[model samples]
Target: MKNILKTVIGIIIIVGIVAIFGLKNKESQDKKDISPNTSSSPSTLTVINNQIQVKNFEGSDFENITEKSIQVNQGSLVKTSSTGRGILESDNETTTIIDKNSEIRVAQSEQNKTKIELESGNLWSRVKKVFGQGEYYQIETNNAVATVRGTNFGTFFSDKQTIFMVSEGDVLAISINPETKKQIGPESTIGAGQKVIIKDGQDPIIEPLTESDKKLEWYVFNQTKTTPTATPRPSPTVSINPTPTEKPSPSPTSSPEPTPTPPEIISVIPKTINVTQGPVNFFVNGQKLKRVTGLFLNDILIKFFTIDEQTIGGTATSELQTGTYDVSVTLFTGEKLTLPEALVINNE
Candidate 1:
C-alpha cells in the first residue's frame, strides 16, 4: 500500500511542475505582445557644420540649435535658414543631413523610425535597410513623399516644386497632393542618378538629372559590400532533327581553332571600398575580375587600388581616417568611371 501511494505522489509532483512552467510561458508571451507600440527608445541630432536653429511649435518656443544633442518628435520647427548644414544621427547608424536652406517640420521620431515634413529647401538622408522590420523613415513635403532606405539620396523643395534623387542606391519618390491628401499616379521607383519632380496640380515626372542640376552633396557608404550575385546562364536546348544528306568529301587542310573570348563582368561592388584597418579581402562580383586598376579617391591617386587580375583582389598598403571621399578608375582604352578609396602608409 505504501509503495502504491509513493508512485501516485510522484506523478502528482510532475504534473504540478509542468503546470507552473506553462503559466510562466504564458506570462512571457503576454509581455512580448505589448512591447512594440509601447516600448521605443529615443534618437538624437548633431550639428556637423555651420549654424542651425530649432523653433518649437509648442507654446511658440524658439532656440538656436547647434553642436549638441537634440531630441526627436518633441515639437515642430517652422523656419529654416538660407545656408546651414546639420546631421540627424540615429542609434542605428542611419544618418540624415539637414542640408542648407531647408525648411522642415518634425512629425514623429522613435527607435528605428522617423517622419518629417520638408516644407521647403533641401535635405539628404541615408538609412540602412533592415529586412523583416515593419518600419520606415520618410521625408514629406508639400508636393511629394520621399521614403528613404537601401540608398543614399536627397530631397529639394524650392521654386514651387519638390525633387528627390538617388545618389548611390535607390529610393521611392511618390507624389501627393498636400491639400487633398491624395496620391498622384504612376509612382516612381527612382534608382541611382535618377530623380522625380512633383509639382502642384500635375502628374509626377521621373527622369535622369543632369550633372549641373544635382546640387545636393551626399555621403555614400558600403558601396563595395552590397551586391546580388548573377544567375547562371541557361544551357542551349538540344533538338532532334532528321540527318542532312551527306555532301561529297573533298581533301581537307588543317584549320586553326578560334581563340576563346574572355568572360565579361556584369555588375560588381567594392566599387566604393572602405578598408577600416589591417588586411581584408577585397571582394568583387563579376566574370573574370581582371583589369580593376587606375583608381582614385578624393582626387588623390591610389596605387593600392591596383589589383591582381587573376585573383581579383589585393592587400592594403596602410591606414585611413574617417571622412567622405570620391573614387574613380580609368580603363585601358581611356574610359573613366568612379572608383574605390585607398590609403597607403609605412608601418615603419
Candidate 2:
C-alpha cells in the first residue's frame, strides 16, 4: 500500500511540473508575438525647402529637420515652417506634398492602408489606385474626412472648416462632428474639378471648382505634373454662313488659365532681436499686406497687425529662443510670402 501511494504522489508531482512549464512557454510565445517588429521600410520624408520639424511618436519632442531626407515611421508628426515645404513618399508609390505652415501625422501605414491626419494647413496628395478588396487611402481633419482609391486632390483646413478639391479622379468626402465623433451628413462624392467644404455642425457643401479656384497657387503648382492620360479637347464646331438679313452670331471664345501672382517681400524691420528683452514689435514692409491674416516667425505664429496695405506688424513673444528664422505672412485667401533667414535673434 505504501509503494502504491508513493507512485501516485510522484505522478501528481510530475504532472504539476509539466503544467507549470507549459504555462511559462505559452507566456513566452505570447510575449514574442506582441513585441515590436519591423514589418517593412518606413515612409520617406524629404524636405523640399526651408525648415520643418518632426516627432517620431507621441510624448516625443519635435526635432528640427532641414535639407535632407529621412525615414519616418507611423505615428510621426510633421510640422512645416511658414515658408517650408516637404514631400512624403510611401512604399506604395503615393506621394503627398506638405505645404508651409502645415501639420500632419501619419496615423496609420501598412501594406494596403494609409491614413494621414491633417491638423491644419494644406496637403496635396497623389494616391495610387487601390484595387485590393480592403485597400484604402484617407486624409482626415477635425470636421471632415477625404478618402480616395486613386486620385489627385488638395485639402485645406482652417478655422474649423475643411475643404477638398479634386483635380483628377474622385474623392469621398464625409462630414462629422468633432465633438460627438459622429457623421453630420451623408457621404459626398466629389468628382474631378469639383470641391466640397465641410464645416463644423453643418452639412457638407458641394460645388464645382471655380475659375478663381483654379488661379490659386496650389492649383497652378500641380498643373506641371504628368497625368495618366491627356485631357480630351472639345470638338470644334463648323460655322454656317448667315443670311444677309440675319446678324452673325457671336463666336464663343475660350480664355486661358490665369497665372498665380506670387507675393513680394521688400523688407522686414527690426531684423535683429535681443533675446534678453521681454518682447519686441517687428514690422514687415511688403506688397499686398492688407490681406495678411497671419504672420509667423519661423513656425511660431505671433500677434499680427496690419498697419497699412503694404505693412504688417508682429509682436515677438519672450519665449522665442535665440536663432535665425524665416519671416512669413499668410493671406486670408491662402497666399503666402516667406522671407527666408530674415530675422536674427541673439541672447546678448
Candidate 3:
C-alpha cells in the first residue's frame, strides 16, 4: 500500500508540471493588449505569400515584400498576386486583412490616425475604440470612405460595386463618385447588423445582412481561420444605371471606365509653426485638400484638426523651431506630393 501511494503521488506531480508548461505555451500564442499594441509601430505582416510588392510614396517599386515591415512607410502600397493573402496591424489599435489579388495603400499611419486605401480587393478591418478627439481609423475605396470609430467591418470592392458590412460596432459610410468627384446619396450610419452597397453615380442600398453573408471569410481576433466552404461569388448582374431616359444600345460592349484625376493642393495657410505652445492650426488652402489623407512636417506626422468641423488642413504636433520644415501631402488616391521647404519659422 505504501508503494502504490508513492506511485500515485509521483504521477500527480508530473501531470501538474506538464499542465503548467501547456498554459504558458497557450499564453505565448495570444496577441497583446490593444492599449500597448496601438502605440508600438506600423503593421507587421503576420501571414504573407510570395507575390507581394511594396511601393514607395512616389508609386515606384520600393521593395519586394516578405513578412518584413522595414521598407514600408507612409504612402507605401502593397500589391498582392492572385494567390496572395496578408494581414497587417498598426500601433493605433487597428488590424487590416488583405485577401487574394488586392491592393492596399497605407496613406497615413501615424500615432494619431491611420488611413488605408483599399484600391481594389477584399479588406477586413478591426478597430478599437476611438481614444482622442480628432483620431480616426479610415478605410477608403474609390467610391466610399468608411470611418471606423470602433468596429469590425469588411469591405469588398470590385469593378462593379463596393460592398460594406459591419459585424460589430458602428461605421459611418459616405458615398462619393470617383469620376465626377462629387458626394452622392445620403450618409449611411451602419450598425452591427447592417450591410450597404455603394456604386458610382448613385445612392447606397441598405439591408440587413443575411446569415450566409456572415459565413463569408472575414478575419476574427485570435481565432483560427475557418475554412470558407463554398461561399457563392457575388454576381454583378445588378444594374447601376439609375437614369430611365437613356435607351439601351444594341451593342454589348461596355463603356470605358473613368480615368481618375489626382487631388491637388495649391497653398498653405500660415505655412509655418512658430508658437512655443498652444494649438497650431496648419491649414492647407487648395482645391482638394478635403481629399488630403496625410500631412507630414519634416517627415514627422501630425493630426488633422477637426475643430469647427473643418475639412481643410488640421493641427501640428508642436510649436515651431527656427528651421524650415518640408511639407508633404498624401492624397486619398495613393499619390504623394511635396511642396519643398514649404513651412518656415522665424524667431527674431
Q: Which candidate wins on lDDT?
A: 2
> Candidate 1: where are CA atoms >4 Å away?
1-41, 57-59, 78-80, 131-133, 214-348
Name the candidate, 1 or 3, with the larger TM-score value: 1
| Candidate 1 C-alpha lDDT tens digits along 128-160 | 665247677888888788776666777878876
What is the full ranking by TM-score, best candidate first?
2, 1, 3
Question: TM-scores of all models?
Answer: 0.50, 0.55, 0.50
Error of 2 at 44 (Å): 0.5
RMSD of each: 19.1, 13.1, 20.4
TM-score of 2: 0.55
Better of 2 and 3 by TM-score: 2
* Candidate 3 local lDDT, residue 19: 100
Model 1: how far residue 90 lies from native, Å: 2.4
- Find the 10 residues in a row with the least total lDDT in model 2: 223-232
Q: Which portions of model 3 miss their true places by more than 4 Å? A: 1-42, 68-71, 218-348
Return the candidate ranking by lDDT, descending: 2, 3, 1
lDDT of each residue in 1-348, candidate 3, tens digit only = 999999999999999999999987675543121122334345565433345667765553556664323435565688877755566677776777677789988777778588888889888787765757888998888888888788878898998688888887898888888976477877889998789899887788888899878767442221122222343444445445578787664444454544444355445545555544433445453444556667777777776532111124445534545688777777778888776777775543
Residue pairs whose backbone atoms clash in candidate 3: 38-91, 305-314
Per-model clash counts, in order, read 3, 0, 2
